[model samples]
Structure formats: structure tokens, C-alpha cells
Target: MLHTSLYCRSFPSPSHLRSLVLSSRLFPSVAVRTSPTLSLRRSRANRSIAMAATEDNRIKRIASSIRVIPDWPKPGVMFQDITTLLLDPLAFKDSIDLFVERYKDKGITVVAGVEARGFIFGPPIALAIGAKFVPMRKPNKLPGEVISEEYSLEYGTDVMEMHVGAVQSGDRVLVIDDLIATGGTLCAAIRLLERVGAEVVESACVIELPELKGRERLGDRPLFVLIKAKGV
Candidate 1:
């Protein structure tokens, strides 16, 4: 459970609220307004169509900011680099604001960020929502008693570690990363949180490579991503 102290903060101001509402309007599938005459299914379908259109526009902005390098780390690989996105303040803020608006009132008590890139996006969200930030680190990065999970990689397996007391039982957690390629890293973070009795509310990323089929590997856990790049 979140501390009562965290609940005392005021909601967003009217202008901020308008911005948040506008952002939701951009993703209508997730924010359909109720209508007395409309059937639930019809409303949902309308929202889905609106969401697709809005998401396409948003993806264009996000995708443009990213730099794609062909065969960088290895042959036949196209790396989507977010460092270019960071260079554009508005794009970077849009990425973070989208997450903040979605999770601000979600009752998320903790934000668990996967090692490096997650570290960049997770803290701002944690601060905005008054949630505690927990780092899911590489093995030995955390200087404390830790629990580690070994996950498969393309060529081999690697381990991620977290501090023993970073999360409490029943904490509602959101996992954040810059991107999802193979899904193994996010899965490892989810396993670590669930192992400690924390309820993982969702896993989020700025970008997703759907070709990798990472979402299928998450089982029932929901994945929310801003942009999906079909190829690179």
C-alpha cells in the first residue's frame, strides 16, 4: 500500500488537466467517453479506431526523433537509438508525459526500472505520481543483499538483480524501459517483482519491436508502449 502522505498532493491544475485530457483524446481506445445511447461494444470499436489514428500520428513524431542504425552491434541488426530522442526536449517530454498521464492515478505504489534506459524514464514518473522508485539493476550493481533472476538473451543468458528491501509485499508496481526487443529483460524484472509479492500493474516502454513478438512472451501481464516500429 502507498503511504497516506503520498496521497495529500493536489491533482494536476486546470491547464495541466486539459493537457492530460488532450493526451487521452489522442489515445481514444484507452479513454472512450461514456455515452448513454451507445452500446459498450460500439463505443469500444469507435475508440479503437480513434486510438489507431491517434497512435499513428504520435508514432510519427516519436519515430522521427529516433535514429536507426543498420547493423551496428552486429550484422543484420537495426538499432533504434533513443539518444536522438533525448536530444529533442519536446519529444523526450512527450514520451515521459504520456506515461505520467496514464499512470498518475493508477494506484501504482512503485516504479521498477530496468537497468540503464529504464533509469532515465522511470524516476520522472515515480516523482510525478508520488510513487517510490526502485532500480532493477545488473548483477552486483546494487550494494546490498539482492535477489537475481537469470533471463535468456539472443546468444546467452544474463542476470538482473534488485535490492532485497526495495519493494514491499503487495506494492503495485509499473515496470519501465526505453524499448522492448526480445522481452527477456522486462520478463526478468516482472519475475523479480512478483517473486517478492508485488503486484505488477503493467510494463511500459517508449518503443516496441513487434516483429520480435515480445508481447506474446508476457503472458497475462499488460504491456503499454507508445511506438511500434515494424522494421527498425
Candidate 2:
């Protein structure tokens, strides 16, 4: 007997194809996920990636704000001028914010700033972290029983002075500076702080000259830098 129905098979309707079955042995691979753990993990991964991208963008913005002056102090020198960065409100605030964010919870008791440019960035950072600001000045700049450390420079040597009893024993100190060249100034600051029995938690700087190998002189002390660029 000829039967047309025997040759035909049923096809899934549009609604069935679009539906998500909680459990289906026939289509187990396409069944809806019963557990939320995988979803949560994926969500967390996405947020982490977004946060990293935001941080990178902020660093780029801060780096671009600095002006590069050619042959200013001498010939063949590419000076990184942060004064231009200061002109931009967002950039300057961002720079300070980055430093504060890192040390706010570190239990830093004192913020020791290297003379000149460090004065500009150090006080605000110190104030934000509720730490005392101690100025590491040039020779003869600080009054009243100051201790001095002489460090080697590219050509010769220079002296840095700090007030007596500024940072006492057991004080956790953070050294701040604008730029690091040959690491002479930062090493001197570290020595001065350690001499008074203070622990140099770490050093912070806005710019770094990697080509000069300043980090080599810094030794085991961790240095946090916002930007790495050649200034010579």
C-alpha cells in the first residue's frame, strides 16, 4: 500500500526553535545553564579588563601633558617640563591622585620631598594621606641642626640637608621627587631618612630616565614612577 504520510517527518516550529529548555536529553548541549557560577566569573573578568583599560588611558593622558624642551639647560638634552602638565587642571590632579591612591593605606607616617619640584607634588600628597611633610632641602636651605648627605652627580657632587628630628625612629617614610636622572638625589634622600632610623617605605617620582640606569643605584628600594621617558 502506498502511504504518503510514511515518507514525511515532523519539523520544529518557530517557537520551539527559539525556546530555551531547562533540561532536554534530546538536545542536552543546547539546554539552558542551571548554574550561575560561570556567568558570575565572566562578568568579573569583563570588569577587570575595563578597569585595566581605564588605568592605561589615565597614564597616557598624564604622560602627554608634560612638555619636552630640547637643549634647555644644555645642548642635546630633552628636558621633560611638568610645568605644562601643571597648566592642565585634569592632568595635575590625576598625577596627584595616582600617587595618593597607592600610599593612602600604606601607613606612611612622613612624606619626605626632595627640594624644588618635589615641594610642588609632596605637600598635597602628604596632606591627602594624613602624613607629615618633611622637606629634604639643599645645603644651607634648612635651619636649625640639619643633617646633610653628599651624593654624587653626573659631573661632580651635591649636598642635601634635612632638619633634625624631622623623621624619628620607626617612622615609615616615602620619598618624593619630580624626576630621577642618575639617582643621586633619591639615594641621598634615602640615606638621610635611614640615618634618622626612619624606614624608607619607597620612593615616588613623576618621571624616570631608564637609559641612565638610575634604578640600578636605587638598589632594593621600590620606586613607583608614573612615566618612563628619556630626558637626554
Candidate 3:
């Protein structure tokens, strides 16, 4: 199914062969022995390249599993839909595995999921790492006394609320959501967590809309995302 062509050239003598090999950057070590440090560096570089290729493959599979709907809810809106991804067991598991393996030993005590979509990915990650899952709801949807932060939306502004004791002071937290667009919702979630003296470890999302420059909106908070795409 695939073919690679090989080209050959003649070397008049052994000296000519050595000169040709030395002249080519690809055959740097062919003509002479390399230092141990140089050999180690080359080995590390090769391993890194192989690891990067594997990561790229995983990203492609997760991206392909998602569905894109054009002009969704309103015209001019390209929605990155993940319900299709959830239906594919392998893709969905792989997506979650990336997050779980990264934070399993990071000492994340609380995993906060933002509103509706966050509810989907947060629990499994928390369960995997033995962390508690807390829901950051909207308005008075959460019972009892709640902390609220109003964030700017594309159209207007909305409030995100959290229960009084969901996250304790000095608790380490990892914020979770399905996607990050303008980053308003995630920033609000961060504000709520910090107001209680909790340490916002990092934020994680499955998809990101780089065109919106949302990652820049988070300031110093580290935002980890799997797939980067436009109009999503």
C-alpha cells in the first residue's frame, strides 16, 4: 500500500565514501565515533520524537471523534460538539486517561466541574485519583449559602455559584470543563475557588478555541487542553 524509493550514488574510493558521509549532516556519526554525551543527547532526541508522534496520533483520534455543527443555536456559530465523542468508548476513555494520568499523583484534593458540561468529565477524573468532585452551579441552583461571581458572556453576563463548604480553605483544586471559549466561565470558577482560600492548581478542558484567545485570559493560571481548534 505504501512505497519508498531509494537512490544510490557511487563512491570512487574508501576515502571518497568517508568524505561523502562526513559531508552529510544525516550521517554525522558514520565517519567517526561520537562523544558519550553527544550519543546520549541523540538518543534522548530520538525518544522525544517518537513520544511526540504517539501523542499527535492520540490527539487526532480524539478530534475526529468529536462532531462539528455549523451555525448552531444561531447563525455564525460553529459549535464543537462532544456528544459523539462520548458515544465512542475508546476515544472517550483515551481523552479521560490523558487527564487522569497527568493528575493522579499531583495531590489534587478537589476537582470542580463548571455547571452542566463539566458534570460529564469531572466525576470520572476525581474518582480515578481519589479526589472529591464538587459542582460549581449557576445562580441559586445550588442549595444553602453560595459564593457567586458574575462573568461577561458574548451577549451579556451570567453568575456562577458554589456551595459554602464545597471547597475548604487551603484546598488544592483542579477546575474542569468540557471546553473553553472566551475563558470567562473558567475565570469565574477560579475566582470562586480562591475566595475560599483554596489553591487553584490548574484548569483542564477537552477542547479549546484558540481564535478567541481564551487561554490568555486566564493570566498565570495554567490551562491544559487536549485539542485546539477554531470556532470551538
What TM-score against the true fold does each predicted structure earn? 0.76, 0.83, 0.78
Off by over 4 Å in 1: 1-58
Task: Return the lDDT, model 3, position 180.
Answer: 94
lDDT (tens digit, per residue) of candidate 1 on 66-105? 9998988888778889999999887888788789889999
lDDT by residue for model 2 (1-232), tens: 1232221223256455454342244445554444689888989999999978977888999999999999989998999999999998988998899999999999999999999999999999999999999999999988789999998887899999999988999999999999988898999999999998999999999999999889999999999999999877
Give me candidate 2's TM-score against the actual structure: 0.83
lDDT of each: 0.87, 0.89, 0.90
Query: Of 1 and 2, which scores higher on TM-score?
Result: 2
Q: RMSD of candidate 3 to the true fold?
A: 9.8
lDDT at 187 for candidate 2?
97
Candidate 2, residue 97: how far the Cα is off, in Å: 1.0
Identify the candidate with maximal TM-score.
Answer: 2
Model 1, position 96, has a per-residue lDDT of: 82
Evaluation by TM-score, superior candidate among 2 and 3: 2
Highest lDDT: give the candidate number. Answer: 3
